[model samples]
Target: MIALHDAVGRLSAALGGSPAAKLAASALVEADALGLPRFGIAMLDEWAADAAPVPETAGAQAVSWLDCSSCFAPLAVAGTTLDLAGTARQSGIAAVFLRGVRGFGRLVPFVRHLADTGLVGIAGAEGPPFVAPHGGTRPVIGTNPFALAMGRGSERVVIDIASSSATMADIKTARMTDAPLPDGIALDGAGRPTRVAADVAALLPRGGQIGSLLGLTVELLAGVAGAGRGDAKGRGVFILAFDPAAAGEGIDWQGKLAALKSDWTDGGGYWPRGGALAAGTMLDGDFAQRLDTHLARMAGQAGC
Candidate 1:
């Protein structure tokens, strides 16, 4: 098991001190622990190597323009921007947009960082085209994703979700592991429903219209804010942060949100197989304990 701090250290070095690299590592490691193939070991080497590559020019910053000529340079710059935004929020109003960057691996970890710091954060990204807009099978939209983080006293809640029903990475991972594709997630090379991951040629929106709408919203927010469109060549990201304490009702808001979450879980029911006695579950006794051990081991492997 790898402790979170140690994992962060190795990943930070591997990705050349970029925030995006750390976020990708966290996602991969966390997904590995959850037995999810898409965000697991398959990503480790590429992520590490991607971080270490030298850029032709160092990233530059201005009050209104942030420029990184090399694609990979933006990862470190994005991390720095997030740190600054988080720090600024400590003083008063806490919201800022980071634009003109590229090569962000995923959006989750950035928001997770804000949650860890006792603040709320949201991140949106527009990238290469992969999915089609509503009512169209042709690929015209990128698999944009929006991530959110909320702090609840000593604990934090994190959610990273794609506007599409499934991310292209998931399909690729499923192909790598020979896992069955989830229903309604993808289309075959011939643009037909296909369960074979290897046969998948493209991804589909999660709930058709609803998913497409969500994807559109994310693209507009990220793309229109000087971030390129989802189908555009370059990638862009927008980050927002908030300090609930600044609202003068942090505790109250937390309590209410917690209650709503509890109620929702109670009414909606637990996940499928949640109560089943599986081999993995039996071996670990509990998920949290198993995760702690796994993290520790990963940390050791990374020489952290």
Candidate 2:
């Protein structure tokens, strides 16, 4: 993990401290920690190979406009605004807009950064319209996503979701791994529901019009800030952060939430799909012993 952080740092140095690069690196590491194979080890080689120069603009306030220069500026501006909001928690509410940027790899890291700072964070990004509204055959709106992060006890709870039934990257990853995708995610080129990842021509909304409403809400949050339209022209991102203490009286909010969670779990509930697996549970002791025994063989394979 330390080596991975160092590698990401080196990449960021080449990108002129752009927030997009830093957030991407952090998201990659967090995904690795969560053992998500597609977003974890598989991406390291791609990141290393895709170290092309990313153009950036002069630094400005959160409400200021930025010239992305056809780079991943939406994420960069979002990161900067998130960092500013973290500091602004000392005051009251902190809302910022990041405009005139384009392209964003993944947006979860910006929300996670605010959560890591002991603040509740919500971020929304509006990109090209890639998905059609439910019951429609043609593309009508972007697969705009909203990400929320809040400090939960010593750990953080991060939820990144797209109003669409699935993200384009999710479909692509399912295709690459030959994995069965969740139902109601995509449609065939002929506008019929399909399971084959390759046949996915457009995405579906999360819960029909309700999801569309949420998508529009995200659009408005990302739009009115003077950012570009949600069409294919340019992209925009809006971020908001607030400290929990700012709302309630002086109390250990984390502890209270943890207690509530404990009570709810003890009360019993349906098992989540895939069963509950604690962190690091996949690395069994027997597997670790075998891995140690085969260290020499692993080294030889590396040389080969």
Candidate 3:
């Protein structure tokens, strides 16, 4: 196991000392800590090399639109979502329609950041077409994921899931480890079911038509966010945040939440949340070695 701070420091050094680098480093480490290592520091160089795009912002009422011109920097995407927490606080509710970006990692961290601020956050993203519609062959939809976070501080609930049976990152990790995917998770170019991750041309939706419907929902939401027709090289992201205190529920929401927690616990259900790694968290030997090798290569390239 590799210490969290050690991983962050190495990633930061490899990416440089820019503020954006630090943000990406921290988010990537959080990904590993949250048990989503497929989206973690493994792709540090890929993320760091992608420059942040400039978005044309258009704001009206409690909503805003950010039309980025090209590919996204993970840093800019996360930074923008963090900025929206303040907007939600002021407006009680706020939303942003994002388009013309790609390669942002997991949506969990973004919404989790909002939930930490005592706001309810909802986010969905449509990625490159990597999944097929129900009962159809060929790629037509992304491994779209939706995420929602609610509650305050340590007491929170978070839901983040992809509509596809498997995510692109999962495939990448499978390939990296030379591991075969579970049966029925993906299809080859001819749309036949296959377990070999390397031959995966597209993914199957979770629960057949039901998950297809969710993917359709994400696509339509992206369309509403101003994405264009045809193959989507970039991605569309939807983010909405609201201050729960503004809901006019006429009750102590936090206290009620605590009561609900008690009941949930008594029922053997635990609160669902993602968090930073414990101080003792460490990376395994293989991943730690990978990090060291990548960092050394980067340093050598820079003649350091």
TM-score of each prediction: 0.65, 0.65, 0.77
Encode model 2's per-residue lDDT on 78-115: one tens digit a residue. 45655556454766456565555555445566666677
Q: Which one wins by lDDT: 1 or 3?
A: 3
User: What total of clashing residue pairs does each candidate reach?
Assistant: 12, 0, 4
TM-score for candidate 2: 0.65
- What would you estimate as the lDDT of candidate 3? 0.74
- lDDT string, candidate 1, 1-304, tens digits: 4454454456555544556556555554444455553434344322223233332123222112233333343354445445545454656434334444445444565666676666777777766777776666666667888778776443346666677777777777787999898787777767777789888766787678888888888777767664455333355566677677677763676786677666756899431211111223221234335444544554555563
lDDT of each: 0.57, 0.60, 0.74
Which parts of model 3 have CA positions greater than 4 angstroms off?
6-23, 34-37, 47-61, 69-72, 169-183, 188-200, 223-233, 268-270, 284-304
Clashing pairs in 3: 1-282, 1-283, 2-282, 2-283
Indicate the worst ten consecutive residues by lDDT in candidate 3: 47-56
Error of 1 at 42 (Å): 7.1
List residue ranges in candidate 2 displaced over 4 A: 16-24, 28-75, 152-155, 170-183, 188-192, 195-200, 224-226, 231-233, 248-252, 267-304
True lDDT of residue 1, candidate 1: 42
lDDT of 2 at 128: 70
Q: Write the per-residue lDDT of candidate 3 for residues 1-304, one digit (tens) a residue.
A: 7887888787776676555456667777777677666777665455423444445355534787666544334665665676688789999998876776655567877887788788989988887788999898788878788889888655577887788998887898898988878987889999999888889899999989999999888887765554622424567788899998886778678888778877888999967675545667777786777778777766766663
How much does each candidate deviate from the true structure in C-alpha RMSD? 7.5, 7.8, 4.1
